[model samples]
Target chain A: MTVLSDIGHLLLTADLWHAALAAAVLLLLPALGGVISERSGVVNIAMEGMMLTGAFFAVAADLILHDPWLSALVAMVAGGLMALIHAVVSIRFRADQIVSGIAINIFATGITVFLINRFYGLQDVGHLPPSELLPNLQIPLLDQIPFLGRVLFQQNVIVYVALILLLLVHVLLFRTRLGLRIRAVGEHPEAADTAGINVYRLRYGAVISSGLLSGLSGAFLAIGISNTFVPNMTDGRGYIALAAMIFGKWTPFGAFIACLIFGLGQAIYDNNSIIHVSQYLLSMLPYILTLVVLAGVVGRSQPPAADGIPYAPGTE
Target chain B: MAASSTAAAGRPAPPLAASLRRAGRAVAVPAGSVVFAFLMGAVIVAVTGGNPFAAYQALICGGFGLLCSGGENAGLQVSNTIVFLTPLIMAGVAVALPFRAGLFNIGAEGQLIVGAIACTTVGIHFAAAPAPVLLPAVLLAGMAAGAAWAGIVGVLKALTGAHEVVTTIMLNYIAQWLLRFLIIGGPLQLHNGFSVSSPIGAGAHLSTLLPHDDKLIVFGLPASVYRVHVGLLIALLAAGTYAFLLWRSSFGYEVRAVGQSQKAARYAGMSVRRTIILTMLISGAFAGLAGAVQIAAVDHNLTDKYFSDTTGFDAIAVALLGLGTATGIVFAAILFGALHGGGAVMQSDAGISGNLVYVLQALILFSIAANFLRTLKLRLPAVGRAAGTPAAEAPAGALAGESATALADDEGLA
Candidate 1:
């Protein structure tokens, strides 16, 4: 009862809401990316790898360049390059996407550590200066509002960017012609190819776009939320984002809602001192919730029709 | 053509030569993939301003103990590799069996963790029991825990049409967190230790292959220095069991049939759900055995080392590179075992990160999955003509195709 009251009290606080929103945005970006990538028929379990690569490069670039924007761009490019390898292997070579995704993840983990050893001589990647870190933008008058203002207006610049991306992705996936083609390609590539929709181009673009979003999320994690990059600092957040995407049925807005739920859990986890539950047990909640959702208790979640299948020309 | 010509001349081709040629063809892709990975690894090392040759020399010395510039003992290195590969053989079989059922079991890591947890729990509880009683109890307990862990994935997949990949990923995290919870202040934590469980009783321990005696010296080192244990024999036995089960059993046919086409298998009167569930249970058991062996022969307790354990993930590469054959899995396990053993030596001797082993592993996976040499052959007609026999498609191809239909069937259920 005390634990319940403690969680309830924490939830009522403005700080908790503010932290929750910030945490949600971190997952939202990648969840959105996952929504886009999976909608385009590529089973992208590699988001974790792409995001890790992005986080590594973001810190590495920021340490050298001292420009957060450029560092973020570099991070995105690095992630995009990783995505390109995944694309080439799964798409061009007709390899197993899951195997490719696993390879990408292993590659990211190995390369990041290897690069760190080479450059830092087994030392930690040092902390960034305050000015170089991605700034928390406080919207002047808007931040003055009681709880909503603190939650929405006073947040990291990347949070704002992610929220905007979420809206844009929702619109782009549902309303636009390009979005239609991407969905068409994912649903039935052969039919889409027959319709002259250029299935490969759309898939390539969708996959790269996912990498970009995930990279941005990584930048947010490394430079916006935290000051220094630790090994595996992203931990399993990218995977949680994948869960969120599936939980939301691969819709951007739905994924955002799912992210918010997971983000709330993260925020609560951050306030573990107030709660009586073991932190490790608390950490298992998101995965458990996702599993419950997958167990059909929350209704069935379906993937795109042709998802994970390589697009071979003239194939039925 | 040579065989055909010889046969046309009223005599069959020599059995040895024909078998040798067949074996050579079987070896080509995996061998090429390894060579490709090493070449790519060399490029990565060179690009990073490291001496690839020196790094590889160190790796070779550490793995096989052939080229030793660092005064490292050869016998110890080989022993270290044997210890490293003991669990991999079973874990590889775990992954390979699921692939045979067209169900990707990414939860082997999770299953292994739970197995370790169960083994530790049982061994600790039965600390006063005799060796004969405790040993089998702990191992069976481990296997049961692992099976239960993976059984969730299988049950959900079979009943609700939930994709095994997503469910397994979820379970993996759950198992990881559970392991953390158990060792770090949960029921299993050691009294004075942090992030480690209490050691299992001596009765539960698997005896080392060499006698554990400081007084006995072999290969210029104490016999105790060799950590290779009876688990190696168990692992080999597991591989043999897998081959026999896969090739000879009626259940094996059902698994293969289900893997090939669930609908067709169902039409042919085999229960697809039963096969799927049973395959996962058996797969998990093998993984559990791996975890049990590690506790019995190596770690002796659940430690923080299990937190960063990549054996299960590495098993994927092993299963794929091994072409899902028991013999191939053993050989692949050996190669991977060498790489893992060599990694530390490379770091210490060549001033390169041991993580390069993982990089090489990923490169090999990429090479195998993409069949890069096949593509290279296509581009070069000269090369293509030389290898007239088409490369055997990897078993992963069957898995890849089956997953698509399986996923499609899920949508129909929804």
Candidate 2:
């Protein structure tokens, strides 16, 4: 009995770090997309669809190509293509950004299912073998440390890359004039235009960047986290990431922490004494947390002034 | 000058005509797009070597006309249709309500399922007594539970400044899981089976109405035709209540005011937080009621599949179709119910892919959303900002100032 309890305790304790890692990966996609959103002055709500599409493609590639790395690459490309459609519809045609994003999601979900069913003769896909997976990396000295080693050091490449991107994003946004321009366009594109920055060009660039990052998230989820994909597998993580982004008040570093909080909430629901609750309800934890944060927080960190507003040249 | 005065003349017929024209425009894209999409879906079914018409027939018969495959044209068919329509109505309202406030409540699926569970618990536990007392008590409990679930999101948005679209969507998954837990491990455990289900006590299950008959009566004739249940009445009442709240009350006014312009509403001295929270709660309650009715009236026991299904999300499509009105919700629900009813038919007999329904629905949403955006009118107070495009015109009685931002750049690249 004591041994069982101790094992249970260890599992529970270890789950927290696992939760954080998962949450961080989830957070990485939206934070990356949002950084671009703030830069270009739009919200990337279709992230759920994009990530789902990428996950499907990642698994599809691995199944077809039998190469995990190549599959991940293909997934990224697929994600990029999905985002590109969104950019064109919302940014170029001057469609409502949120509506456009939703459309992209609907499109991606429907298209992926339709195509996969056609190609594979069914809905579900086969899993990739271990040799086809992304190999995890370990930091030599640091990986030998106690708690941090397992939590931070000995994770897959995506986690390390996500952390590195977090810092790099900070530098790129705060240090570079281009970052200033992206923020400028996001907040007030008319002002950016006045300042000689091409608002159209900058906004387009931001949305594409969002696509790339979100795609990476999807690819990582399929290839690194798991070696398979099912229909609509990302299962609202993109939306959860959206919550994390807002929870962190839309700042990258802040979003990382917020994502971790969401991850913790997810872990708690699973590990809690309320073991009788449905997994469906348990999955809603992060969303519930996001709602709490959104409702509780003041409108302190506002989106750029022109964030969802379309920028037709000469209108302002 | 002459044309301008003519445009202004005698309570202009132009607005009505314009709206009609806009409505026409609205239906066009969806019609074309859906036709094309269905054509594609048909191709899919054909490719799969299924007869499209046979599938459509099967879908209609299976989804609405019968509980069991052989039950078609039996007394139970009509009851089945009403059974399917009940939650869809509530969910449609749930989706539409948020949309009216320029919000989206994607958590309806979660809210409905949880609400259903809450009602089922009360109904079952309380059912050790008389029917009349237990029924009303369960209904109230269900409503409260549903309201609480939805109200959480409302409260979150009010306090934290989060987007309801994302949060509600996330909450949906949690709700599904929670429903599963309750069913499989807790009070909802079934009577000796591997399936996760509950045993609702006697007198707690919803009773259907056939006016003068207890058995299924069709059109006041001989055979048992499905009559409506108390849920239909409750749904109707909810719709009427929403209409009253949205169009007539101060709170509704404030909600609309906030949705139109939160900054302006603040300037107008309206309590934005209270309105956001209150509206979300009310809408959520509606979703919860949907679940209650489904459990108490339709399925006596809980199923995890029902909790996690797309009904709540599909309600969003319904709400969009309904123009965010309660009356609209009813029609939207029926339309969606039909599609759901038709899905099996399309798949098995008609040689049209069952997924065509989703494609058509998505097309319709895209069309409505596009038309909704295209018809808005946004004019700035400043002189230099008055270059109004036709896409920004206000349709009669349709709220203006969605004066949407053309957020995309359309650089459709390779």
Top candidate on TM-score is 1
Residue B86's lDDT within candidate 1 is 89
Q: What digit string (tens of lDDT, one per residue) describes model 1 on residues A1-316?
A: 8888888889898898888899898888888888888899998998898899999999999999999999999989988888889888888776778888899999998999999999987959889999999998999999999988988999889888888888899889899999998899888888888888888888888888888888888898998888887777788888999999999999998898999998898898896586656678978888999899888899888899888877766333
Off by over 4 Å in 1: B1-18, B376-392, B402-414
Compared with the true structure, what per-residue lDDT tens digits does model 1 show for residues B162-190? Answer: 88889988988998899988888888899
Candidate 2: regions farther than 4 A off: A1-23, A106-109, A121-123, A138-153, A261-285, A295-302, A313-316, B1-83, B156-162, B191-197, B209-230, B248-258, B261-274, B350-353, B372-414
lDDT of 2 by residue, B224-259 (tens): 346467788777788888888888998778877767
Error of 2 at A210 (Å): 2.5
lDDT of 2 by residue, A138-159 (tens): 8899988887777888888778
For model 1, fnat equals 0.73
lDDT for B89 (candidate 2): 80
Report the poorest 10 consecutive residues by lDDT, candidate 2 chain B. Answer: B405-414
Candidate 1's DockQ is 0.58
